[model samples]
Target chain A: MNQFNIDIEHTGDYAVIRSDGYINNLGGEKISEECCRLLESGCRNFILNLEKSPIVNSIGVSILIELIERVLESDGKLVFTNLTSTIAKTFRIMGLLQYAGAFPDELTALDEIKKM
Target chain B: MTVQEIKEIMLTVPMIPDMELAVTKTVESLSRFIPFTGDQVDEVKHAIIEACMNAFEHSRSADCRILLVFKVGPCKLTVEIVDHGKGFDPALVEDPKIENKLFKNVRKRGWGLKLMKHLMDEVDIVSNRNGTVVRMVKYADAYRKEALNESV
Candidate 1:
């Protein structure tokens, strides 16, 4: 199986993490670590693009919840862009949508984050 | 139709996190033989992964193994995930949505069992000191109804 990976890009005042592959334990941990590293570097706003990741288990969702908490603790916002319908529904059921917002695309997410 | 074509795939892997991808992919591949819609396939994939994760989390020993059995029938798909772990009562898991509101920071631990039950048409769990087996089923008739509703 191919291991999951993330590519980070810093744009203006925010950072974006483009994740690929299944977001399980390995992938989730990597994403969390990357987000924390960015957070430490004074990057408060983040947009996570999960377009390449089609599968995510509960463990992965937990990792995302932790990231959301971390971002909120820093008084920043985390948004998800390009979510599959399945993942969108999963997030709704898991109550992540209540705290974090999801946009249709990266540009829309960036637009919303910039306004915040 | 004559006798229903039945296909089976059995896998035993160590209780680890990364193995979930392979297990879910195998389930996805086996489900292709059935007449499930795209959404149905996703639901089955999610449910199996949840079951396997539960097994990984609750297994007794570090070297414990998880068993996944996929049984495909003409009209139904059945998955059984077995684990040699100390089992807990499923009744103890409160509804995540309700819990989400009561707790300040929403929890991530309790959503797996609820999701498995919601996604699959049928679910059965049997656990004891020996091991745990989670059986999940999805029927083609449900998809037929969905197709009918979509066309209507």
Candidate 2:
């Protein structure tokens, strides 16, 4: 309900980050910072749940792209779950789909990430 | 009352953080009268936000103001975002690809126009030294068509 809020849950194998509210520059930076901290902790696989954060701008998405590149550099995996139609299409248009995966929910995304 | 009336709204907000949400709030009100579906509404909000962010980040307007006009017609919505700042040529903006953004060194903040174009049915940009105007349209006709097919 805030302008932006991020909640991260670390499972044994991967992490699930739930994002809520509009994703602008500040929101993106927050997400990036969290992902960095997770990466430093040796959590490579990630499933980002965006159900509560349906609205996003290009700047925020660009930061996601940056995160994708950084994770790929480490041979880590990233997937998105609970994305709206527009978000999925935007990812496709921006070619993020080529590097990451998008599923209907966290369980599906987790299944996919495990195979990666 | 013989002719169809077009519902319209004009709003002005300062170029600051989170002002785009104000414009989208107006859009939500308009969508109630229009025929846009949930997906279409999300696309419109996203496109509008991108436009506002582009101006907020690059326009550097003296007054730091953004002007938005929403015109609602039959099965169509047209939005124009204007900023009275030094503008650049839209043709000169480099098309960003994920390949380059992923492997090579580049800034990742220039995907605004691309997003607006893809999300809207039509998009036209006019820019000069005085200001910039981004006019975009989203038609509800496609939704209507799908609904009609479903009913058939």
Candidate 3:
């Protein structure tokens, strides 16, 4: 099944990527590409909305790490919002939580990013 | 002693990352018949994804295939993922948890094996000149008890 897609929305200084599917290799690649595209457009801050994505593999997590690195290189911040409990736990185990912050909703994430 | 239904499923898929969804979904569907809690099901799905992804990534052969065998018994569920590719010793692989540098990097790979071992009740990896088979098991009774205790 084609169980991965993303929609990008620009809000002032950052872009929110709403991902709708399992975040595996396919989903991860799409997210990385979208983030890179946005980075080139001078959008450094990012809020990744993952409420629709309940599952993510290590490959997908690795891809997210790459995005985090890219954002850090640009002195930008990448935050995660609307994470399922499973994904949140996985991210914590993989050390993604150390490099990024996760909020319960997108508005909170956006508010935090705006302050940064 | 208790008598419980036993069910088995066999699935074969190409060695590609995108096929992970199909494998996970099939396992989730079959797990409904068993007594897996929501947390247990998530753990099972994560472990299965890692096994399948490892097979697809490590198997350099263009025509490599992955075989999944799932067996559900009275109190436990076991899944075996077999891949036809060059295998490495699981013992030789360093634990990502022990290696603090790996966790610090965040981008460092090798979390797959660690996660599979952590999520499942038991994990066995057998690799030889033929191929590698990763067998993982989860105990329904244990998780069910944990869930029940949490609700208490």
Among these predictions, the greatest TM-score belongs to: 2
Candidate 2 chain B: worst-modelled 10 consecutive residues by lDDT: B1-10
Query: Model 3: what is its DockQ?
Result: 0.46
Q: Candidate 2 residues B15-78, lDDT tens each?
A: 8788888888888889887778999998999899989999999998999998998888767788
What residue pairs are clashing in model 2?
none
The 0-to-1 C-alpha lDDT of every candidate, in the order given, reads 0.81, 0.87, 0.82
TM-score of chain A of 3: 0.95
lDDT of 3 by residue, A50-82 (tens): 988888898778778777877888888999999
Candidate 3 residue spans exceeding 4 A from truth: A1-3, B1-5, B61-63, B97-107, B141-152
lDDT of 2 at B24: 86
Model 3 lDDT tens row, B16-84: 556877887887888887777888888899989998888888866445898898887766788999987
